[model samples]
Target: MIKNIMQKVMALACSFIFSTGLAFASTQTAVTAQLVKSEADGTVLICQYRTMKKIHFKVLFTHQVCPLAIQVGH
Candidate 1:
């Protein structure tokens, strides 16, 4: 009886840990991008992200029309 209870508890704990880790991982990589400008050349996107280092990530849509507006994080 005690062994079974312990096993159940451990399983629960492990699952909780895994779920939390996945959630954290997803949040860390998630970012929001805004259409800054659009020209005949291409469209520019300003991305917002949270991280330790400052990285300059630019998006340009040369052939496609600039995105009107977007609200997404992934």
Candidate 2:
């Protein structure tokens, strides 16, 4: 009947909304984590590619440094 059809349509709409919200939340969390990691690291590297119109940047943390480099003098 019409009632059954309405129920199915509502269910579909609710599910779609829920899924979209979840996707947005996950993306926000990932960006926050990346920012935190970059801050914990001291140095920042930036690179630009003119032909591709792209830019890349990274923050280097202390733990990421090579132990061998640190021990080079010792």
Per-candidate TM vs. native?
0.36, 0.35
Whole-structure CA lDDT of model 1: 0.56
Listed per model in order, the count of residue pairs whose N, CA or C atoms clash below 3 Å is 0, 1
Candidates' lDDT values, in order?
0.56, 0.42
lDDT of 2 by residue, 1-74 (tens): 99999999999999999999876674223221112112333453322112122223443544553221111110
- TM-score for candidate 2, please give it: 0.35
Model 2 spans with C-alpha error above 4 angstroms? 26-74
User: What is the per-residue lDDT of model 1 for residues 1-74, given as tens digits with 9 covering 90 to 100?
Assistant: 99999999999999999999876775536444555444443354443333233333335555544454454445
Deviation in angstroms for 31 in model 1?
Answer: 13
lDDT top scorer: 1
The runs of at least 3 residues in candidate 1 whose Cα sits more than 4 Å from the true structure, single-residue gaps closed, are: 26-73
